[model samples]
Target: MRIGILTSGGDCPGLNAVIRGAVLNGIKSHDFSFVGFRDGWRGVKEGDIFELPRHQVRGIAKQGGTILGTSRTNPFDGENGGPERIQATLDRLGVDAVIAIGGEGTLAGAKRLTDAGLKIVGVPKTIDNDLDATDYTFGFDTANQIAVEAIDRLRTTGESHHRCMVAEVMGRDVGWIALHAGMASGAHAILIPEVPTSMEQIFGWVREAHDRGRAPLVVVSEGFVPEGADAAFSSRGVDSFGRPRLGGIGEVLAPLIEENTGIETRATVLGHIQRGGVPTAFDRVLATRLGMAAVESVAARQWGTMVSLHGTQIHRVPLRAALDNLKRVPAERYAEARILFG
Candidate 1:
């Protein structure tokens, strides 16, 4: 059988491991031929692809990012015939199934393609770890570890200069990264997009920390917005996939916090750094498991389903189920994180 694979949305650690795992297993065990889509959905739409073989995937397990490349191109954003075009491209390539690895937008696009009679299997890939079906995505643990280490380094610098340090990590409309890393590093304050905190309340937290003679370390997700502060930072621009760009909240919030409180402040946007570099051992194992499960799902003809990590086993979940609601940091989880707050 012939299969296709593509990675989409933001680049994350362990992507290459997933590609390698799927190709290696499919080729060795099932004698399946695989082709990779270049630059995400655009590659599928434009017919840009390359063959995947065992030798091509050698020694890529520890590597970060993806060999298949990725993009934010949403085929359905403008054209009505996008699905038809995709079908034509599949026919030309003679692929029997497609394995799509990405976050929400990519899965949504996959769902549309499946409805249009394409055989698609999904594997969740979000640095935020916000997909509900899986307990965790491959990249989330790596990102959280990176952020925690950064916070640990920033703590010493913040204490030496007696300043408030705000470290920004990626999370759009969810706070899984922020909550986990903050709890892990014992951050003074953890801010997320789910619960908007007032500047006055935030100032009080900072001041209280200052009074206790502790240098404050605040971990804020890039998607976090201050309460009633939409006038300052509006989501108005389109990304490559036509999704609204969600960033810059940390830079905006830092200045506001510094001005409100008398504490000297600095903002460090972790940005793409957390998504790059070698995958941790944990990520490597999880990604390999997910990849093997995805291949099995294809073999079983489980279209419109995603391979998810539930407890110790990789389970199959409906694609729509994972995309229906974002797995935001719940109130209880936030409360646990708050216990570590200064």
Candidate 2:
């Protein structure tokens, strides 16, 4: 069998591990040939690809990002794009199945192609841990670790200067990263998109922490909007996929926090840094397992299914099930996080 793989959306650690795992497992166990799509779905539409033999995947398990490259390009765009053209392109390449590794958008497109009669499998890839179909996604651990380290470093500086520090991590529509990182860092205040916090509440937390002789540490998701702040306040602009470039929420909150609490404040946006560098051991193993499971699903003809981590096992579920509800930080989890807050 000839299988093609593509990684789309934001780049994250452990992506290369997935590619390596799939190629090695498929070639060694199933006698499968592999090819990789360049720069996400645009490669599929434009017929841009390269051979992905088992030998080529050597020594890449610890590598960050993907060997196949990635982009936010929608597969349904352009003159030569869409299910029909993509089907023709795959047929021309003699590809039998496609494994799409990405976050929400990429998997949604893969689902569409499957409905259009193209054989496709999905692997969830989000640092946010937003997809509910799995216990956790591959990149979340690496990102959470990076965010916690940043907050820890910032905490010390805030202590020395007697200031309130606001550290923003990625979470465009949810607060999983900020929630975990903040709880892990013992942040005084944790703000996320799911919970709209008022400046009044933020000031209360900062003041209490200050009174307790602790540097006020605040963690906020990039998508978090303070109560009464306009939704457009966080928009930096949109990307090629029309997804807004989320930022400035931490910066905006810093001054408000300072003015309300009479304490000096600073903002640190932990932007792309959280998504880069070496993946944690957990991520590498999980991504590899998911990659292998994806190929297994393909061998079973489980089209439209995504390989997911449920408890200790790698399982398969419909792509729609994962997309139906994004796994946001629930109220209970946020409440537990608040137990650490002032």
Best-performing candidate as measured by lDDT: 2
Q: What TM-score does each of the candidates earn?
A: 0.95, 0.98
For 164-283, candidate 2 gives per-residue lDDT tens digits of 999989998899999889989999999999988888988999999999999999999998988886672545678887767788888988998888789999999999999999999999
lDDT by residue for model 1 (64-124), tens: 8898899888867545237787888888889888999999889988988898888999999
Stretches > 4 Å off in candidate 2: none
Question: What is each predicted model's overall lDDT from 0 to 1?
Answer: 0.87, 0.91
lDDT value, residue 236 of candidate 2: 61
The candidate 2 region of ten consecutive residues with least summed lDDT is 229-238
RMSD of 2: 1.0
Predicted structure 1: lDDT: 0.87
